[model samples]
Target: MTHHILKATKENVHLGGFSHLLEPALTIDSGDTIDVETYTGYYVYDKAPPEFLTPEFVDICQNLPPERKIAAGPHLLTGPIYVKDAEPGDVLEVILEAIAPSLPVGFNAIRTGWGALPQQFPQPALRFVRLDLVHNIAEFPPDSGIKIPLKPFFGILGVATPETARTSIPPGCYGGNIDNRELQTGSRVFLPIFVSGGLFSIGDGHSAQGDGEVNVTAIETSMNGRIILKLRKDLQLSTPVAETSTDIITMGFAQTLDAALEMAVKNMIDFLERFVNLSAEDAYVLCSLAVNFRITQVVNSPQKGVHGMLPKSIFSHKINL
Candidate 1:
């Protein structure tokens, strides 16, 4: 089958929030794969393109209406794709095939009213990162020589719900702006259906990020990536569940850390019981001994998240089935 590619354009992109009422820019059948291009998290605030930034991305930012920059959001999302046969209660399997830089540069920012240490940082600062695509390194300063490996991934991949438009900042059951780095290439994300067609949308690409995302940003950059969307009617999920190269992960979002942690643990327990065939007691015990819970991020207000990780190495039997 031919690969369907969708380029990111001002017409097809949105700022904050998602709703099923928004029209789908593209539609594809189940089991079809699509190539999607996305913008960085700073697309809204970009007044001038950096030296290493590409003209193509600058053109996209320039096309946005002035008011959109104010009300839309900082993150520029690509599309609300209509997947054929996707309906509420079904699961949408998003298989991430590839993630590559679309621009020669990326960026990181520190701003007032943003980041985990907002009180300490009252001023906004922006720093450009030179992406050495060949070397797979994100150089901090050409002279300082600070460098980190490239691990590109889209920060947002969500399905719209039947409710009003939801902001793209905080990730929830719909899967918007979940900055889990594990959702990189070779990962498979399963999102619960909330509306017909799943009204899928994705954007906010990141080159690298740590566990907490405590600074409130990653190697923020634009990217071109491919994903295979498959409709799974036989499965049901509440929040986003994913299997990475090394582990099975379950996610949860809420206002408080305690709540988020509880969500992750409970989801892990459910997964263990359902797939691993462990009894509730056994799963609970195993979780205490094996499951690793991590705070995804604390920056997204009222929607901090945690993910429970169960390593695949523990099982001698392959989980391929």
Candidate 2:
């Protein structure tokens, strides 16, 4: 079947979270999927400065308005593309098809307060890298001058919060600002439907990033992507879950390592319970027996969120393609 296409330009609406700009409310049928094509969070900054080897340039670029900025906004969600029969207690499965970069946007390296390794290198700085998508490599022209492998991820994706408006910069259960790098293509992301039609949006696409994206930036770029959304009408999930062909991924967040782990465990427990329709006890046992948790980050302050996963084989079923 042909997928419905929606293209967002610099004009039209708030570029906050990607889900805010969904199309006219349309009810989604069970098993039906919507494929969305997106622009780089940079939205319209067609070219990036090739010599972003200092924090000064990054500061200048980041301060520009959305239209003039070189990187994408904090949020770039698409639509409240309404799912017809969706309701609370249902789960929305976002099958990530691809999240490759549309261009080699620049990377920003901050000084003191921004990096996980800030103290180790007590100087403030910024640098830009050109990405080679085909080779999955990044070129840093600075002193180190070494190329690095690229891992692309969507830094944010979520429905509107059930509570008051939250800043798009922080990662929370509502799926905002979660910089989990494994949320790459071919991964299945599961989020609970908090409101009607599961109003969803996604943007803040990154060309490449490290865990925690600690430097407060990545190879931020915008690109088109296709996501298949499945409506799980009978289940409720507290946090998000991702399944790859080889792994079952869980996410955790907290103010501390312990809290992040707790969040991760709760998230996994929620996944097991709702995905398999198991009771609480059974789900916990399933997590212990078949799940392996992976730490996604430990540097997000105020609270840190973690991500864990188990191989799909451990669950006896391959991740549905």
Best by lDDT: 1
Residue 225 Cα positional deviation in candidate 1, in Å, after optimal superposition: 0.3
Q: In model 1, how large is the Cα lDDT of residue 32? A: 85
Q: Which stretches in model 1 have alpha-carbon errors above 4 Å?
A: 41-56, 65-72
- The digit string of per-residue lDDT tens for model 1 on 1-321 reads 447888877666666768777767689999888988887644434553565345656666667544233234477777888998888999999999999988777778776787788988878887777788899987666767778889988888888887766777888988888899888899999999999999888888888888878877887888899999999998878878999989999998998889999999999988888788889999999889988899888887768889999999999876641
TM-score, each model? Answer: 0.93, 0.75
**Model 2 C-alpha lDDT per residue in residues 51-166, reported as the tens digit of each score:** 32234323323453353221233444445566668787788888787766655555564646645777777786655567777788877764466887777777777765554344
- Model 2 lDDT vs. the true structure? 0.62
List the candidate 2 regions with Cα displacement exceeding 4 Å: 11-13, 17-35, 39-47, 50-73, 109-112, 117-125, 141-145, 269-291, 299-301, 315-321
Q: How far is candidate 2 from the true structure (C-alpha RMSD, Å)?
A: 5.7
